[model samples]
Each structure stands twice: as C-alpha cells, then as structure tokens.
Target: MDQAAAGMQGAHRAPVCYRHPDRETGVRCTRCERPICPECMVSASVGFQCPACVRGGSDTGPAPAASRPRTIAGGTVTADPRLLTKVLIGVNLAVFLAQLAVGSSLTDRFELIGQAQFSLFSPVQGVAEGQYYRLLTAMFLHSPTNYTHILFNMLSLWWIGGPLEAALGRARYLALYFVSGLAGSALTYMVADPRLPSLGASGAIFGLFGATGVLMRRLNYDLRPLVALLVINLIITFTPGFNISWEAHIGGLVAGVAVGYAMVHAPRERRTVIQYGACAVVLAVVVVLTLVRTAQLT
Candidate 1:
C-alpha cells in the first residue's frame, strides 16, 4: 500500500518541458533526453529533438546548411513574411496623402515626364533635364484626383505582394519590385508623349502580377484564374477612355517574369548569383532605355 502511494506521487510529478517550465510533456529530445514541448520539437531520424539539439554540435551553435530553413527563393524563413509589403503600401498611402496636402507641387516634381517647361518662364523640368529620380518616385505616386487609382493598385499589392514576399524573401522581393518598376518607368519614358506625365503603382503591381503567374506555374497551381485576370486587366489598360499606360504594364510584366523565373528556378548551388544577375540584366535595360530616351529628348 505504501509502495502504491509512492508510485502515484511519482506519476503526479511527471516531467515538464525544460524549455517551457509551465507545460508538462511526455516528449524528450532524442539526443539530449531533455523534456520538450511541441513548439520546441524538431523532427529527427529516431524521434523529435529540442531546438538546441537540432542546432547540432552545441546548444548555441549555428544550424547546419541542411538544417537551415529556406524560402522558395533561398531566403531565410521569417516569422512575418508580409512586413515589407505592408511597408510599401504604407509608403504609397503616405505619398498620396502628401499629394492631397500639397497638390501639383509634389506631383510635378515626382511624376514621370520626359521633358517639359510648364510655362514660358518656368524652368525646364523632366528626366531630360536631369530629374532622373522621377523614374523611381513615379512608381509610388497615384492619381490624387482619382480615388480608384490608388484603391485598385493598393489592393493588388496587398494580395500579390504578401505571397511573393514569402516566396522570394525580402531582399529578392525588393530587387524584383524596384527592377520591375524601373522597367515600367523606362518603357513609359521611351514611348509615351514627352509632355504627358504618368504616375502610379501599376507598373510595380503588374510586375508582382507577372511574378505571381510564374510562381503559380512553378507550384503547378491553377493558371486559368491568373490568365483570366490578366486578360481583363489588359482590356482595361488598352480601353480608349481609360488613358492607362500600357507601356508600363507590358514592361513590368516582362521584367517580373524574367526575374521571377530566375528566382524560383535557379539551381541551389548557384541560386543567389543567378537570381541577382537576372535583376541586374533588367536594370541594365532600364538604364539603356532611359539613356536613349534622354538622348532623343535633348
């Protein structure tokens, strides 16, 4: 009877996870035999291990190459994948607010225009006059007069940017975005009327669209939905009354596809080099187009 009571007391005092002192757990690290909760468990050949054991060699050492978590584009896995996307949206919204407060004062300096003098006495202002930053700033600006311009673009960015950020990771995703936006800006400068101004997140969003298409293809997802959406957007872009910049759309889409393809398909051994090399190539195209347009305008 005394032995039975002792056994009962021992059972009540069952081990708790070392890492989570408050939680009781039957699981233990296979290597270290330390009690571990589910959250601390890492799959091992024989059984689960604690995170410390999974790190290999020592409790505080770096994980082995085989053990490190990686994203589809070889970026480190992060807790919050959509952080950068949210930041980009916030920046666009903030810029739009500035446009509202300041009007053409902000728009005139940032919107992509080849070259123009607003009035007879006004100083010549444009990329041709060395306001080259317009190519970048233009991607974040939207039509303050048209609410739907920012609305639709922001929605698209939220929807597409989140998943793409997760897949490509932050650095690669940023590279894809800037390169695609610049591609759009360059193409718009190359072909559109010099006196006309163009600005929007459409180019960057379209780049995300193309990248999303490539990612879907890589994952063997349903392509029909993406195709239908692309067709609809293309129709809207070319519609006579809309006055959308088709050059930006086409440029962003092409750049997105090219960069995204490299991001997802590059061999693991040479992934970083190949992925960034593709971005550099597209950026070169943007620079070339910009230079040619500037030469012509001047």
Candidate 2:
C-alpha cells in the first residue's frame, strides 16, 4: 500500500509554470498554453489560473481582447517603390534612338515611323487601299519636323507623371496615358489639318495634368503649383514660331480629367468598372466625331 501511494504521487505531479520556472503550476492559460501558480492565477468559472489564462477563457468572459491601434491623420506611411515614370522615359528615349538609327535625321525617321492612320505608309491606309497592319503602327510615330514636339511633351510627363503614377499605380496610370493620347489623336484627326502629318505624346502629357487636377480636387489637396505650371505651358502652346497641336492637348486634357474622376474619386468597389467604362465612352465619342469630320472633308 505504501509503494502504490508513492507511485500515485509521482504520476500526479503538478505542471511547472513557464513564467516562474522554479514554481509548480496548478492551471494553464488556454490561449498561450503557459502554466500559472495559484497566487498568479485568476478565478475562471471553469478553473483557477493566471490572469492571462482567465482573460482568454471562453466562458462568458467580461475582460475583452485588447483593442488594435488606429491610424492617425498626417502620420507617415510608406509608399510603393515602383518607378513607372522612369520606365516610360526610358521607353521614349529608346524609341527615339531607334528612330535616329533608322535614318540620318530623327525627324525624317519619325515622320516615316510615327502613327498616321491616314498616311501613305500606314498599314490601315494600305488595308483601306486593301493592305492590314497600320492600325498598330500608327501608335509609334512622333513628329518628324519638330524637335520641341517630343521634348516638351516628355518634360511634362517627367514632371507630372512620377507623383501621379505613384498614387494611382502603374497599370491604371499607363492605361490613362494611352487612352488620353488616343483621344488627342482622334481630336486632331477631326479638327486639325489632317494633310499635315502629326505625331507626339503631348496629348497624353496634357491628359496627365487634367487627371492630376481631378485627383487633387477629390483628395482636397492643394493644386496651385500644378495649375500655375499648366498655365505657363498653355501660354507657350499658343505662342507663335512653335507648331503645337492645341486640339490634341485639349482632347487629352478632357479625357484625362474624366478618367481621373472615375478612377480616383469614385467608390473603391466600383472603380475599375467605372474607369474603364468612362474611357470607352470618351473614346467612342471622339471616334464618332472624327469619322463625321472625315466624311465632311472627303
């Protein structure tokens, strides 16, 4: 009988507390699985244990879980590190160099290579004349006669694109850029001297400004500097001695603002659908106007 009692005592030994390694524990915390001494333990409805164990117990507990910290306004937050503006600049520079390589003058090569849907070399023109690839080719062409055409456009893009791209993300910003450019081209085709071949990214850059304006307004951000810069550029646009596609600029600006409003200001859940729909609607309108004007000219 004495041997059996000693064996039972050894088998029934209490667990050691993790917090107080040297002390024996009578209960355990359900959440953390740490043992607790009776003095450190809390009176849980189910059993005696540590304060942490009692707090975490599931039996109609009065002590609630700790509250999470809230984000405060003006608090510094990390931004995404992607550099979309630099990538776009690199692409434009690469294309410009390629144009220079193809011909002695960058101007001459750009004239031949730039997107002119109605131009003699255009694949779409060939297709209409019964030939097919000009639809895609038209997107690459830049103005052959004017160096400032691409220079100013690129400068504007460098200025406004970095911040906007960082805010909107790469894919959305790129879509806006391309759509705005296409809108500008469509406007130029409709209203300007079509016989005078035109190419450049100014329309898209202008669109960036428009989008920036809308985003600033929506976010309650100050846009005084941006507005001032835009005004100075506009004055330059109208000045004599420089050939500027004012039509393209205006078209791109309108499209950009519309896109920005839809994408940035609209509710988050519906943003994608609304942004794409807005772009499509604007493009359709521009295309219709261009077709109507073309019909009138012919």
What is the per-residue lDDT of model 1 for residues 1-298, given as tens digits with 9 covering 90 to 100? 9999999998888588786688666667778899865445554544556767656646565678787645567776556878999999999999999999997779888999899767865555999988999999999999989999999999989988987897688899999999999999999999999898999989888999999899778655568988998999999999999989999999999999999999878877788999999999999999999999999999
| Candidate 2, 158-239: lDDT as tens digits | 8789667755666677788888877777777667765554567777888899998986675445579889998987887788
lDDT of each: 0.85, 0.61
Off by over 4 Å in 1: 1-66, 120-124
Worst 10 residues of 2 by lDDT: 68-77
Off by over 4 Å in 2: 1-82, 104-140, 143-147
TM-score of 2: 0.62
- TM-score for each candidate, following the candidate numbering: 0.79, 0.62
Residue clash pairs of candidate 2:
41-49, 42-49, 114-141, 115-138, 115-141, 123-134, 124-134, 126-131, 127-130, 127-131
- Top candidate when judged by TM-score against the true structure: 1
